[model samples]
Target: MRKNSFAIGCACFLVFALLRYPQAMLEAGAKSVTLWFQQVLPSLFPFMVACGLLLRMGAAEIVGEWLKPLMRPIFGLPGIAAFPFFLGIFSGYPMGAKITASLYEERKITLSQAEHILSFCNNPGPLFLVGTVGAAFFHAPFWGYIFLFCCFLGAIATGMLFRLFYFSKSVNDFIPYQKTPSPSITECLPQTIADSIDTITQIGGYIILFGVAVEAMKQTGIFHFLGNILSFLPFSEEFLCAMSGGILEMTNGTFLLSTAPDNLSFRLTAACMLVAFGGLSILCQTLGVLRNVPIKKSRYIAAKICNSLCSGMIFFAMAPFVEKYAQKTVPTIAFLAETAFTIPIFYIKSSIFFFACAFLFALYQRR
Candidate 1:
């Protein structure tokens, strides 16, 4: 009852805010749409379609066969768990949750395995890290590489920590695994594209909604007030505001961080923290994907929080080596232009090629 009332009240407030500040809302929505088109769509769509196709084609299960030995020792999970983990690494957020949920629904992975994978599998993909953060925001792909490295280590650490303390000792208890239904490629391709479209559309909606909400807060000076409330912290008001934005929605937060004071370490650390945390928007997306599953929400949230902290610590530990080895200087405009132009093309072409190859492999195996 209380939750319902709070939700209703929040919705009312948002409606009022939208009416009160239509222009701000419009502008924010437009920016979010632009961001989605340029970055999110290009980076996520291909990979999502590919992932879906792979699952339907039974390719991931094939790969899982070989990974069982390694997966058991390190993560205390079945080899199939490797599919979501690596796919999440390559493809990015919510995909991990989606794949895990799909696995659970198919009764391929046990509930325990699903829950264990959920803790650390969902991650920011390399495209976003390298192209969006590295090339566009920081003008240096090097920072993106550093962030990815730290995030990967943090994910590993989180998984290991959970394996050590949280998961039960009896890891061998397995659900009788069922292989995914093998839909023909002709049938699978269209459905995979359709599902990917829906998923990307859902993501865009969240981005726009949160983008407008954040903008509304900023317009109303609520963001500034909130920042001031956190002035007691060691960081600056601008930094606090950026973090606040990030806490609600990661893309906007990182966008703000890019414009913050030119403190490399501070900016990188804050960006990494937000990326790892994945913001409230991402949480909603994750939940949306996993809603039907009986997974424990509290534990999932706790795992993400721990993962965020762990990533920050790992970044700090590796800061010295990264600083020494990686170049942080702003790149030339021509270079940025080159990177920006090529990345979307690369993502699209690569994903298509990857899926085509996988589809052929599956077809050949059937024959």
Candidate 2:
């Protein structure tokens, strides 16, 4: 009770402070709003609607069965997890949580399966990583792709690790429930669009609030206090400030990181780690989607930490190669990079992983 009250008090104070600094608030708020309108909504809306259509048409179940061998063996999750699992990677952010929670709500997946999916599914989408972070921020599209790939690997590694430590279920343990095939696009399209808009609007609100709050904190020197508190970490104050911004909101963190006096390798690794973490704004959105579910937030946070660390490790390993090639700036590579990820390797790999996991899970169940 006291904690809740304290949180409310803090919120009130922040609101008051922001109101006192209107110019800072507007500048911070506007960029987040523009990013959402210019980038996030345009990219996410179609994906959300398409996913809505696909799952409704029973494509998920069909593909889940086909890929059971991989998913079960690798992730120890039911085949049905493949659809949203792939969406989480490709579509980005709370999609994994949204799709997984929707599945659980419909009784398509179990609580354990939903929570496990949640651990690694809530990651940055390719559009942001490649388009915004990679091209706009780094001036290299290939680097964005590299970060996306690292996060992909990190999510998979996290899934496998969770299979070992968290999920011990057999493939056959998943409750095989029938799905209602809604192939009526004529009837569904309008509703799907409406739902997409609503969801995207809510997500934009989170982005705006977090973005503005981070900028406010920076202007108010709240991060200075944070830097002092974290001074024991053996890193520079600038790095600490960047990380602090990241913990609050990813976009803010990304901007701050660009100003850090670190080498490309160090900054790239940090950026990759931050993207993998998905920041508090995204996590809040995920939890909001899963509000009615019985899963714990700590598990989700642990998953983010584990995946971010894994991404950091992978980035370090790939830095030598990435930096070498990144210097080449091959025009051919850009075209290929642009066209190749469009082919849905995320879906293909997920299917294969699903199939593997299913095969192993069935074997485990039989034993």
Candidate 3:
């Protein structure tokens, strides 16, 4: 009864705001639509379609078989987890959670593993991090590479940390994995495209609504109030405002940070945190996709918060190097690959070693 009343009240407030500030709402909606049509649709649609096709083609089982050894020991997850991990990394935002829910619904992964994977797999795609953020926002593709590496580093850390403390009774329960049918490409292409369209449309709706919500918050002074609350943090006014915006939505927050008259290091740190956290808008999108699956919202929220902090720390540590490398003018695929590999190798290997040691310790204790 209380929940229903709260939702009703919120809806009424939104309607009132829309009527009160029609211009702001309209502009916000237009910008969001443009962003979705130009950037989000092009980058995400093909990946979504590809992911749907891969799963439909039984790619999970195949990938799982190959990845089982690495996944089990390091992450304490099933081999099937690779499906979401790689796809989520490549596709970015909610895809990881989306795939996990699908796997759970299909009985490919148990509930606990689904929850565990949620901690780290979902992230912003390379295109966004490198092209949109690095080149477009910061005017330095090198920082984009730094952000990508740090963001992924944080994710990897979150996974290992979660595995260390995770306890579940069904961790050892073996369930027969569902084998997805490998239909002909021509046969499955239409359904896959249809499903991808539905998914992207839902994402588009959320983006536009959140865009309006941000404008509404601004018109009502709520956005300023939120920013004012964080003034004690030693950051500039612009930084505080950007952070507040980021708490509501990721892209908006990062754009604010990029435009703020602050040092590059501070902006980089804050952007990493916001991107990793993925904002309330992203949380809603994840919830929408997983609506049919029974997963704990609280746990997902906690994981995102942890991930943000982890990524922020990484960005801080690497800020010096980023500043040193900020002058790389000719940013290309080779440079990105080279930078990603060289910079994160030490951290990645250390994390893997630490997790492997912990896994062995767990085995010893069990014995």
Position 356, candidate 1: lDDT: 78
TM-score of each: 0.86, 0.85, 0.86
Position 6, candidate 3: lDDT: 78
Candidate 2 RMSD to the real structure? 4.7
lDDT of 3 by residue, 1-367 (tens): 7869977986787898899999988999999999889778987888888888887788888878666666766687877887898788878887898788878887888787888888888888777777667766666766766777788889988988888645452246445566555789998799889977888898999999999988888788876787688878777878888888889998778878988888868888999899889898999988888887887889888888999999999999978754765745534433122233233444456657966875566556446
lDDT by residue (9-50, candidate 1, tens digit) is 878878888999998888889988987887789878888888
The candidates, ranked best first by TM-score, are 1, 3, 2
User: What's the C-alpha lDDT at position 130 in model 2?
Assistant: 72
lDDT of each: 0.79, 0.78, 0.79
Candidate 1, which segments miss by more than 4 Å at Cα?
176-181, 332-337, 340-367
Backbone clashes for every candidate come to: 0, 20, 0
Cα deviation at 224, candidate 3, in Å, is 1.9
Question: Residues 126-145, candidate 2, lDDT per residue (tens digit)?
Answer: 77787667655666666777
Task: Judge candidate 2 against the unseen true structure and give its global Cα lDDT, from 0 to 1.
Answer: 0.78
After TM-score superposition, the amount by which residue 352's alpha carbon in candidate 1 deviates from its true location, in angstroms, is 25
lDDT of 2 at 86: 80
Worst 10 residues of 2 by lDDT: 327-336
Comparison by lDDT, 2 against 3, better one: 3
